[model samples]
Target: MSNETEPAPAAHGQPTLKAIADAVGVHVSTVSRALKRDPESPDASKSVRRIHRIAEQMGYRPNLMAAGLRTNRSYTIGVVMPRLTDVVIAQTCEAIEEAATAAGYQILLATPPDEVNAQLQSIQMLASRRIDGLIVSSIHLDRPDMVEEILRAGIPTIAVNRRADGKLHAVTTDDYHGGYLAGEHLVNLGHRRIGIVAGPRHASTAWDRTQGCIEAITSRGIEVDEELIVHTDFEVQGGISGAHRLLNLADPPTAIFAVNDTAAIGVAGAVRDRGLSIPRDISLVGYNDIPLVSQLPVPFTTISSPAAPMGSVALQQLLRGINEGEMSSLKLPVSLIVRASTTVPRQN
Candidate 1:
């Protein structure tokens, strides 16, 4: 007597929507809506509640792959990022995943080495899987090829953390401002001879921060010693090596500014090995006020970048591009968190 046509049994003897609908004496569409309704909503009707209970009893489960075929949308966002082991990168990914879930999308993540060739392969693989969109975090500044590949895929895409060549839309913190703040803070403390643990040249984030710091220093009529700027990886070991080089100079820097907290930790280690104490032998400034830096014996004076928000906003931007066919870049604000690791230079 049911008006709804019965669907075949789901694979492996699993229950289908029609089965739940037949149990509840309603249309399959109604059952589908009931199952998708938010459980926490206060306005769920009695019939919807009854449908959920019946579906549970019938062991009904939705098949996402089947649903994708029916709707022509995978409802999946591909995320290609490097350095998942880094805490800051991990935090950003967590935010992106959380936002994607809330928006009824799943995340397919691929973490390759932060190199252009490796990333290109990862992006191609994700595109082949028919992802609805892509989110990238480790875009290199000099690689137009990567940007071209992303455009060639013809999917809605957005870059987070670092941007590539200004060709792709991105959501990033104001790295330049953050660097300027670090430099200004050091200059205010009467530290003139400053050393920089500038990260790799190919990253926009690194360049922006380094340039901002240079601007702040030069704006105050202090020349940035070309010898004082050392390019290194955004890792602790890179920090240690760079710091040691600066410390061993004929006229070593009285203050060191590391572009990231991880590198700053390395600088700290190197300083300790040299039998020098922070704010006594050399003042230090670091970017990205990561949680661990705040708890250090000499807490880092660093810039607080909005890593999580960058991920969240990047998702929103990608969604807009997908639905509206338009996207715009955004730069979030950053602030300086002064801590115990910095002080005025000692009198020579």
Candidate 2:
């Protein structure tokens, strides 16, 4: 017997569309069109959005895969990720799954673990399963050819949380602005000498952030010593080693900005291992204010992105591409959350 339970089986007591309808006092069919996002009924869209909120709260997904198979049109979409160990990715998927189920679609997930060959294999696997569309969360910044190959496969595809050279539609945050916000915060606190833990060379998230930080410093008529920058993987150990490199510089920075919250955790460790105190000895800033960040000893001062909404919108655009052959890129806004982790640098 296959341990794999079929999609949307209510046998496990998972909330169904009928559950949403009952909760919201609306009909199940009305909820259906609302999930599709372009409801013909004026009253239907409002009710659907409400039901969507309720379903998301209840952790409901219809598991409509069996129905798709029966109709000869698998209302299933494939999602490719680098990995889901990151809390940010996990939360974003929650939003995606809820939105997809509301729109009468099912999700098929795959992970490539950041290897190009594995990514292509996953894509092919999803294709073989006859997914109606694809939403890729990880894009190798260097590989244009891989994108072309996916496009050539004749599937409606969209990139989420990542981007390439405008060769494909991408739904992402205003990463540049996120970076600028961090830089501005640090600079406003009177830290001229700063270091950045940048991500991969090709990743727009890292590149834009690094660039935004530079722009912010330059705007204040300060020069960023290129020596303070270190490009590395978006991980905690990368933060530790990257911070080490910056702190060892002839003129170390009083402030550091990490690419993400996980890296910030490592950056904080590096500071302490070297006998430094956060904000007092050195200040820190990070991106993607995941929930766990706020609970830390010194809650991170970070840039916050709408991860779940981004996932929801990504699925909507992908389905649009599949049905209408129309596609466009989207950049959501971000905001900075000031917390205890950042403060004015001590007089040195």
- Angstrom error at residue 122, model 2: 0.6
Cα lDDT computed for each candidate against the true fold? 0.88, 0.84
Q: Give the alpha carbon lDDT tens digit for every residue of 1-348 in model 1.
A: 847343444456668777778778899999888876533234668887777666666666556678688878798999998999888899999999998875568999999999999998999999998999999999988788889988999999999999765689999999999999999999999989999999999988889999999999999999998999999999999999999999989999999999999999999999999999998989999998999999989999999999998888888888878756988899999999999989989887
Q: Model 1: which residue pairs collide?
A: none
- Going through the candidates in the order shown, the clash numbers are 0, 2
Candidate 2 stretches with Cα past 4 Å from truth are 1-72
| RMSD of each candidate relative to the true structure | 6.5, 7.6
TM-score of 2: 0.83
**Tens-digit lDDT string for candidate 2 (59-169):** 765456565655566888899887688887877787788888767778999977877789999999999988989988878778888898788878899998887769899
Return model 2's CA RMSD, one decimal. 7.6
